[model samples]
Target chain A: MASTLHDTPERNIPVQRISTTTPMSGVTSHPGLAAWSLGYREWLRFVRQRNRVIGAIGQPVIFWVFLSAGLQESFTAAGTSDVQFLEYFFPGTMMLIVLFTAIFTTISVIEDRREGFMQSVLVAPIPRFSLVAGKLAGGASLAMAQAVVFLALGLIWGMPFPALGLLAGMAFLLICAVALTGLGFILAWRMDSVQGFHAVMSVFLIPMWLLSGAFFPASNPWLAWVMAVNPMTYLMAGFRWLLYLGSEERIAAGTPGLAVSLLVSFAFCAVMFWASCRIAQARVRGDVRS
Target chain B: MRPSPAIVISNISFAYSARQALANLSLDVASGEIFALLGPNGSGKSTLFRLLATLIPLQQGEIDILSISVRTHAVEVRKRLGVVFQSPSVDAKLRVWENIRHQGWLYGLSGRELTTRGQELLAQLGLADRAHDSVETLSGGLRRRLELAKGMLHCPSILLMDEPSTGLDPAARYDFWTYLRQLRDEHGVTVLLTTHLLEEADHADRVAILSEGQIVACGAPEELRKEVGQESIVVHPIPDHAKQLAAGIAQRLNVQTRTIEDEIHVTADDATATIASLLEQFGPMVSELRLGKPTLEDVFVARTGHRFWNRPADGDSLDAKGRANRKGVRNG
Candidate 1:
């Protein structure tokens, strides 16, 4: 189909004569262009695919509404009386949006590898880190966009979205998005099939989300210990605190402090980003696992 | 002083697990030549193409492109080379212009320069009218042309393509070659491609025939054909009698003969004389006979003593005699 963007009436644009005589070493050497182009292409593809945009934002909203409605009467926390199930599930649903968007965006890596695009990119002159960074940045941006939409739903659910708290929440969500997308990139880079990738998400990602105190509070000592060590738990706590910022009643529920949440989320982002770059560099050096 | 060759691959070997894909393969492609790596399936031409394109690592030797070493100077080598893989590499969701634009950015071209270059390549490849169309909607031939345009977007001095005609129809293949020749003649870009089609290889300035991970023949098409013989005489004996007739012909005429399917092939300097005598000797036993000028296919058979088209299927066990013959062929 003809693209709506470039379908303007044809004009006689003078064709500039490209000089092929430039020495190989003297060609323009802007390495960052590769990363920008890759990120931009991903953004373009994501926006054009209407179903992807819908599913990333729609599925989580549906999940949050249905799951909270089903569990609202039976759910209770030991430390708080004012926190309802829907209010408690809000941040988790935002996280779910981030997770789905991240997973959906990074899944293209496997398809790219299969369709020969990855091979072409790999053989290009740009540094390997640029490719990894581009994918992580692209996936993270999409994840954050969807997360912001889910976050806006907090107002309709009667949770106050204070300005500073919303800013902090946005920053926190961005960090989480980058970390989750980078993690997905690492997994997708090594996987040969999307089916194998889905199996991994089911076995690893869903459990990580469940244990992050999203569905239930970490009140028991053993479950608290697990949540204390879970990186996502800190993100969930940070998100909840941001959502219920001005209310002391919800704050008394004892989510982790803001500083600790930001620190752990940043650390997780840095670690995942580094790991993704390492995997991409290994592939560049011909250590492809597949 | 002679100009340096465009590509020089020396003594490179590669294997997947224990099965060797390429072994001690060495060849030189002169600058501005249209070179073809010719082979049947699993003959390692594709593997060799990957090695030259730097898609795979060199295990045993060196490949130099325009005097730059592929192993040590891979980034520089990549800068000078453009590669078109056999599979479709264009993103289906992106427009043709966007596909080339992204490829240009990979080589550090951007802004006005990238846009103008993309337009120029689209014009050169006869895709200017469809530049805004989504790649998924294009035919296989147009997609392939878009791939070529993408590969050449950075103005690479040397272009490497793996089976560039794999999915193209006959007319499309002809058009593709026309563009390739234009690239070489007008811009002096060296073109290297791998193909199993004998006619495709015949169109190249030079052809390197690979068999069992080794080169069995390398030369211009006419030269390789001349080396095989001036003419090839194929005799069709009745069914179930080819092997006996081949053996009889070898014994009676003392010429090298090989049985392929239900026919016996004998290469001769004068096909008329050979056919006349064979018919006189065998008479009614000969079902049919044909004489034709030696083709690249004949050159392959002459060099490898096996038909190019009917390679034994993978995992088929070789009898002891076939094994020994293959070993002798390899050693010799």
Candidate 2:
């Protein structure tokens, strides 16, 4: 791997750092409770501000209403999928919300680098991944919270809820949340400016949002194949699968998509987790700069 | 020194793109001494500081902090290094106590120990009274203090401040320097800071002046002053008349003439002759003139080709305050 731009090749390299060989896991060096406190503090920082709290929950709720209304006519004209636009998209929008939330949370890394918060974290006697993975897990936890509120929104919208699978659906949602945030964290590591970061993430975010059945039910054979390749499609499929558990015919029809999407998303998370660690290590070796 | 250099750097060299930032720069902060890296902008002081704090990896040198290699043993290195960046880091919505506690958690502290240490650090930083207060409400100086406390919450071996005095008012700047002295006298924390203020170096056991991405000079403050000392004269001739005026003054005084900040600055053992010559010959065309002892700017100009604050080259990432972010990979 080429060292980052910060690494001046000809000079005596500092301690050679072999970074990111495996999926960089876990940032909390102090056990579960300690990690919670760290993450909880991060949560409290954003939550105590009532506007931020409302903003977090309100975004997806509003997206559901507006996008559902916009796509209602399309659903009526569609083939025998046997689902309303609102029902089909509830899970997709929830996934999109988690995806966006992860992006927003990860942007904090750029902000922290500007303010010196990152310097404070790096100086602490902890694992290097604490700087990123801790942020990832913390963002995931918050995404999970937002996901629950969104699912509750789905319940109120008259979508057929498979009562027994709600917990399982939530479990899958948390996994998606972790996976999304992990990728966001890795992207955050490479960008130094907010404007540049948002510009690049929007490229990924818009394409993924469009392809993952968030606004449309992803039915075109050619397009569905492409959507099948998008990792987020699995999250939507998994949520839909769980939501339709007691129903007949349409239940788990997308199981292969579900299995494939989830595996791909996990793979993305693994790759990103390792990428973040590599970037962090490169920074430590003076090869990369924030 | 009781706190021995919790950090040691030797022959550190860094660059931004094709330009070098730290050219064979080296320094040591005896544990507990408030070492200050002094220079004007583009002096590579921030790059040196970031390297010592482990913000940037040593590209062409070696750094050992409390016996831990910053490269291979970064985890151990981080355990001892604490950084207070030039910009704000604490989230505005987080309470002061919460920010401090979060830093402790990153260091693997928890429960009572985290809380107690957080409290103690807040108290030590004079932020105890505002522990529950939201960080956004704090003033610039207080926020910086909170940043310092947050950095030190882990009881780091070396505490670093990169232009920590930038945003403070005059009173706060003075008090801030005093508090640094107390950090050593009371807590025995090794301190290394970067500053643009000349008087700021008065407190340093030693000071290094960096310019154009190189350590141009380094020594005790008084020694540096004495070496670069002697009378200095600066002349501002009527629009675009510097060359004519410099030639006139140099010929009379038989000394070196330099142009800095659009003015003809002449330095010699005795500037009396130079000033007299300028007043006699060039004074007719001169618009402004001043004579004084060689300040840090003189010390810098005596070595580097420009004034201390004169930015000759873009060297690092710049914050809103004009401080560099020390991104040696590709700086300004």
Candidate 3:
């Protein structure tokens, strides 16, 4: 009934007040720090979960060895005269590694929500865009790290690894990692559970990878049209061009040109990144599904 | 001049799909006060907490925290608010210090300054020795303390907590309250918390009891209790005749009576006199009777005309006197 009763002096005890003002340094005020901190947290979680790290990398390696070995004997394509299935599937497996790492890293978004950490972050002073960027960066880093390990295996497998080619291929992988992880982040952001995310990945990510010129060349007109629209197709083509720089015979004939592939991959990365930022901003307007 | 109130909520309402959680609710909390939003489950206390903490968007009405609008100036409001959610927010994989440090970073505290503050909070929460341990290794009580440490890492001027003592043991709850009081006393931090527990509400300096998205009673706990009555007299008639006995007592004594299951509850200023008169009038019908001081639970019952813990049965009539009591309390 009393509106101002809580303000009475008798009810308020006299204790030394600690000053509430925080020292404002430019570094602390920068939104980048929030992003960096979030990214660091994600990295710590990833490395500490040994099983996750192993599963993310090992599954792709097993898929590469088994799928290529099983298909090498009977696999034949119109453009390739003497190409081995192992060589043909090498770039696909690299993409697979990136995709696996991306999925593993972005899955934490759902876990964070369940654990209540996302709620705390949502209420903080940091911008929502920074949160998105931080998450993407964290996931992209892990994806790229695993992709590099597989790239090393490509080198050992005698897929012509020129120094410039390796550098270009790493750069391409980085771009692809950012793009794929951003896509995964968008999917995971709207998903409430890991099973839901997996279902979405199966419906969306797997088909995109399959349609990319990963296993067989898109020699047929219909399949080539589908592959032309797939972003991962450019990624696979660009990676193949970079990995076998001097050996044009080893590269698939129908794969897009290096410049065209780079341009498309960059465009895809930019669009995915921008779309993710928009989704994060939309969440501020309370468009959250959960 | 006195400082502005820490929080001002006006005409706020929220709904999840078609089910309304809060409706046209308004309240104020002064700076450096321990204010409790008391209610049973589904009373909209948690909804109000989420709105104040800026965890959820304001769908209708306005809320201001520390002079910043929660709708138009959410980031600024967030800067002044430290929230501990009802669910555990600490990352189980991260060490105690890492969690605190990460929270500090989100509030724009970094470098050596953030580290110092993190250590200070850990030490203050009695978690200095466990700073290096992973959060999963800590017990529930310790984890709760760690959550508090993370919330306070940024030195927020106002702390919003939802069911803060939900999973704590009795001793941990005591320690939690002590820390809340210390924050108010030593640092002048205002605290607003939601609790379904009556004892927790009793410990607050002021409480607002919500029922079905409305504030049924709001004032100092003692004042609210006194407003209802100083004492309550409960009588148990034969199970089948409980409703009849309650109606007869209300008509004869001109006192409000509510029947919850087989028990007839009446609020009286003089319990001994009421009991003596009741025994003389209806001794054969009365099976058991007891007199006790009014509690927060009693206040809720008086204002709502139903048990706080149980939903009123379908098709039950609300007593007119109880409606008047609620109207009178709300009007003042």
Which candidate leads in DockQ? 3
Which digits, one per residue and each the tens of the lDDT, describe model 1 over residues B1-332?
Answer: 32468899999998987989888989999999899999878899887877777777788989999999999988888888899988878999999888998898888988887787788778766789999999988988789989998888888899999889867755566667767877887778899999877767888999999999999999899999888787777777876778888888888877778777766789766667777778778756777776666777778877888777674453321211122211111000
Best by lDDT: 3
Candidate 2: tens digits of C-alpha lDDT, residues A1-290: 22221232332211111112212112335534444655676587567767666777788788778987887766741443676677667777778778877887888777776655666666555555655566777888888888888877677766677777787777877777877877777777757788987887778876887777666755558887987777677666666665555563454233344466557656766777777767665453212233
Question: Which lDDT value does model 2 have at A8?
Answer: 25
| Segments of candidate 1 deviating more than 4 angstroms | A1-26, A76-78, A242-249, A252-254, A284-290, B1-3, B311-332
- Of the two candidates 2 and 3, the one with more favorable TM-score, higher being better, is 3
TM-score of each: 0.90, 0.79, 0.90
Write one digit per residue (lDDT tens) for candidate 3, span B131-174.
99999899988898888887887778898898898677555676
The runs of at least 3 residues in candidate 3 whose Cα sits more than 4 Å from the true structure, single-residue gaps closed, are A1-29, A75-82, A283-290, B1-3, B251-254, B311-332
Give model 2's share of reference contacts: 0.37
Residue-level error in angstroms, candidate 2, position A23: 38
Taking all chains together, the TM-score of candidate 3 against the true structure is 0.90
DockQ of 3: 0.34
Give the lowest summed-lDDT range of ten residues in model 1 chain B.
B323-332
- CAPRI class of candidate 2: incorrect
Interface RMSD measured for model 2: 16.6
- Between candidates 1 and 2, name the one with more favorable lDDT: 1
